[model samples]
Target: MEYRSEISEELEAWERKITRKSSMVSRSAKRIQNRINGVIPERLHSIVTNSIKTMVQGVLVGSTYTVHPPKKNRSLQVRDQQAKELIRKYKRIAATEGAGTGAGGILLGLADFPLLLSIKMKLLFDLASTYGYDAKKIEERVFILTIFQLAFSSDDTRRKSYRKISSWDESLSQIEVRKKYEEHDWKTFQLEYRDYIDLPKLLQMVPGVGAIVGAYVNYHFLDWLGENAINAYRTRMIKEENQTT
Candidate 1:
């Protein structure tokens, strides 16, 4: 009977160890998953900005070639070549400077993505005002974008922003905000700004603007999610304690 009891105790101890190991493995897996999910929004942001920039370039080049033909004079040809070279030089500068579309993407990867976002948003607002977009409209758009970001953030870290925004006692639901912004007419949206800042112009304001916005938003959101998750786990613990009592 003693030998049988010793065997049972050994089995129970092994089961406990296995349970602990399994729990550790599960936690580790979740941490890794969270890290992986955190980076996705940043990548998406870069892609969206890049696509917009490419479209703008196509429109600009097509309009230049189709709407205004260069003069046929030899002197004009020489001037045209020089102008082309200058454009190339400027393009290179834009690519490297914070004023380029790629700059936004690059900024997203940096450690200071949030700072970059604030700076870029300010710059864009100024540019919009200069172009003639109404100040109120510009502010509204910015707020809309911020809210859209909070709602659509795929990064586990930025879930905090989602919670904060969601918890607000406002008349606008998250879905409503997203729909309102999305349904806004593109022409009206652009016209609302005082300045006629095209995609390239807007992007050039912040180096790697796409990436910077993505990363910062993602990181912030994920942090919120992490906190909420912890709270949820603690609640479960409390519930278990109450049951025991």
Candidate 2:
């Protein structure tokens, strides 16, 4: 009970942070991203969009990408501790993948995109299981995508994504909940993610510094994603709990 109360307070504080107004630096970063998008050729954008679409589809449909069996009836504190351990485990895997590809030059660096994405999605599945959810459900997968976008998007997009999931039960109920997973805003989702990490990832392709950059970037970015996933899910879980009570 005491732990639940403490977690509830943490969620309250996290809500305030997510809802806060964007600062000047954030606005400027968005503008810069817009300009960069304009500068990049449409052909390249199409290629990236197609690549991400294919990669994501493969993971979503692949047989090997199994969800953790749901942890039935666990307390929130125990669940969260397990989730944190899973996140840490994946973070290390991502860092190692990044270093391996980074050391292999441009080709390997390119490979890291899909590889790291798969790792992140797998971590989300484990986290969902720990939180007593089944990742096999269509709505749950959509929620996972929402968490992914929340992790990778720009400030403005993050704010919008956060709102959609923050009231997840109500928001999810409004959706048609297709089993095919075709309704997501893939274009905007890919664009925002690409633009957000473009510069650092681009530098990661450089020969001499590639390994160091890849390891450092992947390590930190996984940590960022883990933080977002935890807080985002916790927000929904807390909201649902309050309603039930």
- 150-183: candidate 2 lDDT, tens digit per residue: 7787777788889888778765442464543566
- Relative to the true structure, candidate 1 reaches a TM of 0.21
Could you list the CA RMSD of all candidates, in the order they appear? 24.5, 2.6
| Candidate whose TM-score is highest | 2
lDDT of model 1, residue 104: 41
The reply for model 2, stretches above 4 Å from the true place, is 21-23, 41-43, 55-64, 172-175, 179-185
For all predicted structures, in order, the TM-scores are: 0.21, 0.87
Please give the RMSD of candidate 2 to the true structure: 2.6
Whole-model lDDT per candidate: 0.35, 0.78
lDDT of 1 at 51: 39
- Off-target runs (Cα >4 Å) in candidate 1 are 1-111, 136-152, 155-245
Best by lDDT: 2
Model 2: ten consecutive residues of lowest lDDT: 172-181
